[model samples]
Target: MRILVSNDDGIFAEGILALIRAVADLGEIVVVAPDQQGSASSHGISLHRRLVPKPVDLQIQNVEAWSFSGTPVDCVKFGVTQFGEQHPFDLMLSGINEGRNLATDVLYSGTIAAAGEAALQGIPALAVSLDGPPFPFDEAAQVVRKMVDRLQFKTLDADTFLSVNIPAESVDGPWVVTRIGAEGYRDRFIRHTDDDGQAYYRYVGDVVRNIEDDDSDITVVNKGCISITPLRYRFTNEPAMDTLKTWF
Candidate 1:
């Protein structure tokens, strides 16, 4: 299968490199990723500035790689739009993200955003994330490769994609299909003064899991299981529309 791989962690990140290595045996891989960090950039595309994708040597023989001066979503856009005619892709993979993107994190994760972009464009996609530090990037990637091999991409809809979150440790339980649950962090901003006496603030946050959420991504990962959540592009609340119809 021809695959288009992209990530928010830039081209040289260990996680992306490991992902490339893990999936190399699958098929022809074309990687177009951001030149720098793009973690929580979400689905915002660069509209004003010219997005130029520069060819970069990833040192991985036979695998074409490019570095784009844009967000993760932008990288996917550039790749699929510019190269789709010549090298039509069968699948799109994003992440092996350095950090976990679970629950509400999907709203702000550039990793998921990239995969979501592909899903919107009639392509099957998967976004894999690693939870916490001491991340076994290479190992997590291999798990994704195995999972991908088993998944029937043909069954997936044009507006659907999968959001996968792997535990920092080994998975002892079964990989569970869960819903996006409550995940919130306490935000803190420490004020600092620069040499010019200008006030600056450094942001700090800590993850708080909803232990009560049994059928959720956060709780699933905490229980030593891989969380696989099928995400779709339809945001129009069907139930809410019914309620609105009564009001009108």
Candidate 2:
């Protein structure tokens, strides 16, 4: 199986490197990732600027890597399309992101966007993330390795992708299948005054650690279990179709 790896974090991030090392034995691997941090870039592609994939030396044996000056989605797009017929990708692993992407946070996450782009191209993908700082990327990579192995043996549905979140400490329980939480970060704003007495509000958010629903991704990770949420591309609200019809 040929695997395409990418991340929102720059090409040389430790998390991505850890992930690459863990899954090295899987198959032919090629990495195309952002040249700089594009954390909340979502699914944006470079439309105006000329895009290029610069060959990068990750110093990892037998793995070809490149750095792209675009969004994470761009990396996945370049990896899937530009590799020619012989290097068709079977799977994409889009993170080991330094931060968690839970609930609405996925809407803003380039990490999730990379995985989403791969899924859009009919390739099975996984977006892996660590909860907080002091990230144990090696441990998370090992866990992701097992998940990837399972995905390799048992095929994933074409339209689906998995978003995984690991805790800062050791994971205690088994993989808990969960859904995206209803709520996102508990946000706040702090106002600061500049030299000219201009006030600027700084955005601050602490992710809601737990939720009432045990099956929600937010709560699952809080309970010391690795949360695995299967996701698919969807925006149409079929349930609201009837309401719209009545209005018309």
Candidate 3:
């Protein structure tokens, strides 16, 4: 299998390197990732600016890598359209990210966005993240490698992808399939004055609240089990559309 790898943590990050090491024996690997971290960039593409992709020497045996001066989504776009056109990737794997993208946090994650971009192109994809202050990247990568090996047997919808979160410490049990959690971090901003007396707001809030659902991603991860949440790009509210039809 030919696999395309990308990440929001940039190409030189230890997480990505660990990911490459874990899956190197599986198949041919090509990496296209951001030169700098694009953490909460979501699925943003560089529409107005010119994207520059430069060849990077990772010195990893049997892996060709490139660093793009754009977001994680841009890396996926370029990797699929350019390199994939030549080699034809069987799967696209993003991250082994430095931190967990749990619950609604995936909505703001560039790591998950990269995988989403690949799924949009009809390629199978998965985003891997580790919940951490001290990230256990090797363990996370091992989990991801096993998942990748078994992905061929699983069936997913055209625009669907998987978002995986692993505990930084040893897991208590086996991995669990979970639903996306409705819970998220409460938005809070701190008002501050600059040295020049200019008032500004700084985003500061680490408090996360998870929904009561036991099958939710947040709940599952907190229980020390690896969470695998299947996600799709469709945002249409079908039930709402039927209710709104009466107004017309």
lDDT per residue for candidate 3 within 1-248, as digits (tens), equals 88999999999999999999998887788999999989999999998998998998777777889999999999999999898887788899999899999878889999999999999998999999999867978878988988888887787888999999998875435799999887767778999999999999988757676445899888888888899999999999999999899988
lDDT of 2 at 79: 84
- Model number with the top lDDT: 3
- List, in order, the clash count of every candidate structure: 0, 0, 0
At residue 244, candidate 1 shows an lDDT of 100
Native-referenced Cα lDDT, model 1:
0.88
Candidate 3 runs further than 4 Å off: 193-197, 206-208
Estimate every model's Cα lDDT from 0 to 1. Answer: 0.88, 0.88, 0.89
Per-candidate TM vs. native?
0.94, 0.91, 0.94
Question: Cα miss at 67, model 1 (Å)?
Answer: 0.4
Off by over 4 Å in 1: 171-173, 206-211
TM-score ranking, high to low: 3, 1, 2
Cα lDDT of model 2 by residue, 161-235, tens digit:
999999877544578999999776788999999999999998888766544587999888878889999988888
**Model 3, position 210: C-alpha lDDT score:** 46
